[model samples]
Target: MRVLVTGGAGFIGANFVHQTVRERPDVHVTVLDALTYAGDEASLSDVASAITFVRGDITDSPLVDRLVGEADVVIHFAAESHNDNSLSDPWPFVHTNVVGTFTLLEAVRRHGVRYHHISTDEVYGDLELDDPAKFTDQTPYNPSSPYSSTKASSDLLVRAWVRSFGVQGTISNCSNNYGPYQHVEKFIPRQITNLIDGVRPKLYGTGQNVRDWIHVEDHNTAVWAIVERGQIGRTYLIGADGEVDNKSVVETLLELMGQPADAYDLVSDRPGHDMRYAIDASTLRSELGWTPQYGSFRDGLAATIDWYRANEGWWRPRKDATEAKYATMGR
Candidate 1:
């Protein structure tokens, strides 16, 4: 099948691009990205020759329509992701996450194409530390942050289109993802990069916030499963059953790097920080018979750390770009 992967140049998206091409040689994939600071083309450089890369924003209805019309399936992954960045300003999140999803939904509806949405579990808000609150397909959304609120809105739009217009589609909300090719602004990679630079690893809040972590590769696999085998007009929760407190994650990194636990710095948490997040992925497993291949968080963390250690050049430039932006504002 010919598929269009929106925002496929970004971290998880780029990994999806590579994995898709490798797994299904017969499927042709097209990636549409705005090439934002977060959407670096270099991440997909290795597979650049194989996949169709279109540097465009998802809000462009005409572009999205054209691409959707030519493909059998569209995987919508484009969005302004990052809670810290979202809180500083929310307009971009609305423009990309909300309006962009609307644009893609309209395009896919007109084209009569099947679509899949890649969403985050943050939409369910925080679970009480002592009480379990794993978000399932039936969970009601209670997004607290700008990033999640906008994502929740986007998800609503997708559901509306499916029910009202009979658009063939499925949505998969996944837990926190960590792996190689990720931008350094994210929690795991940022902490890893800082540790490697001999700087204190910054932990948001008490670092007690809990999140169900899944490797990006496994998340991509789940997405493909939804696209290929999932039921139409349904939402699936994709998780690795790997849950950990933020402090524990940092401590694990320290142990892996042979650093002292005191090497961490407890910083002010981002506004509206969720206390915990987990996902009930039984729907995907029972329906699609999909299981996570990466079950051990320790193994995943070790492999991811090694990847960053071995590929400094990739992340160094990204960090430099963010630092440059800060410099520009200061000047």
Candidate 2:
């Protein structure tokens, strides 16, 4: 099988490429990434010799069509996904998320290739911190930020294409992901790198926002399962049932890194922050017979910290700029 991974240099997509090369040596792999600030070729360094890597934008119809035509399957993971960045500027999100998906759908439809979409649980908006409900496949679309709204729009495009155009594809809306290769701009990596620099971690607002965290490896594993066995046109939710509040997450990081739990600073929160996000991954688990290997959030976090500590060279270059952006937002 020849697989095309869009945004394959980004955090989750890079990890997916690595896993495929490691476990499925017979499969030919081609990666298409824009190499944005969020996508780093260095993340795919170890597998550099194993796969074909193409640095290009997905919205380029000719490039996308040529690439999608050559692949047996295309896994779409590209997006402008930082909520804060989308809040400040939404055009990039719409172009990349919505228009890019449309471009891919058209190419896949023309080539008769199987396609899979990677999305997020943030598309369901937020559940109240006190709410007992979790996001399910049956959940309604209620995106809050420009990021989630555009993602929701892209997802709708895939569904419509599958129904009207008969494009063979599946979709998975996953929860928060944390692991190596993740940019320092994200929550888990940012705090881990801050503590590595002997800087206090910054908590936004009262730090009560909750997220369902899953290791990147587990999310990628589920993606592969869906690619192999999932029903076309069906949407799957991928999660590990790892839920942690922002405050507790910081404190846990402090404890794991041998610092006092309260050694972090509080900052103003971003606008349109969602209260909580949780995923019901029962479909991925029961229907596809998949389960998370990182069942414990702390254990997964510890492993992530170890990776950042052991590979400072990879994330160091981006640290200052990321913090400066957060500082401007007073977060």
Candidate 3:
């Protein structure tokens, strides 16, 4: 099988590439990436010789059409994903997320290629901290950030293409992901790298916001399962039941790094910060027989911390600038 992956150099996408190359020798993989600030070719260094890499934007229709035509399947993982950055500038998010998905849909529709879209739980908005409810496949869309709103719009575009144009595709909305090659700007990596630099971690607001954390490996595994066995036009939520609060996450990182639990600062929160996000991945589990290998959040976090510590060269270059950007927002 020949697979074309969009945004394949970014965090989760890069991890997906690595996983596919290592496990599926029968498959030939081609990566299409824009190489933006968040997309680093260095992330794919270990697998540089194994796959074809194309530097281009997903919004380019001719390029997208040519790439999508050559592939047996296309996995769409490209997006302007950071909520904080989207608040500052939403146009990039709309262009890349909304318009890019439309471009891909048109290409896939024309060529009759199978496509898989990666999305987030943020599209379902937030649940109260105490609510037992989790985001399900039937959850209503109520995005709170420009990032998520664009993602939601893109998701709707995919559904429309599938129904109106008979495009063969599936969508998976996952929760927070953490693992190697993740940008230092993200929450887990930010706190881990800060502690590595002997700096205190910063928490937004009172640090009560909650998220369902999943290891990147687990998330990618679920994506592959959906591509192979999932029903077309169906949406699946991918998670490991790893729901954790921001405060506890910071405290845990501090403890893991041999610092006091309270050795962190509370910063001004971003606007429209969701109170909590949880995913009900029952469909991915029971329907497709998918399961996460990382059963413990702390164990997964420990592994992620070790990855950043061991590969300082990969993340260190971006650390200072990322922290500076956060400082401006009081995050």
- TM-scores for all candidates? 0.96, 0.99, 0.99
Better of 1 and 3 by lDDT: 3
lDDT (0 to 1) per candidate? 0.89, 0.96, 0.96
- The residue-by-residue lDDT of candidate 1 on 1-331, one tens digit each, is 8999999989899999999888889989899999997898898898888889899989998888899999999999888998878977899999999999999999999989999999999998889988866788888899998999999999999999999999999999999999988889888998898889887787877899999999999999999889889889899999999989999999999989999876797767667888889889998998899998876999999999999999998999877665465345431
What C-alpha RMSD separates each model from the true structure?
Answer: 2.1, 0.6, 0.6
Name the lDDT value of residue 139 in candidate 2. Answer: 97
Clashing pairs in 1: none
Q: Give the C-alpha lDDT of model 1.
A: 0.89
Clashes of 2: 0
Model 1 worst lDDT window (10 residues): 322-331
Cα lDDT of model 2 by residue, 1-331, tens digit: 9999999999999999999999999889999999999999999999999999999999999999999989999999999999999999999999999999999999999999999999999999999989999999999999999999999999999999999999999999999999999999999999999999999999989999999999999999999999999999999999999989999999999999999999999998889999999999998889999999986999999999999999999999999999998888888
Cα error, residue 13 of model 1, in Å, equals 0.5
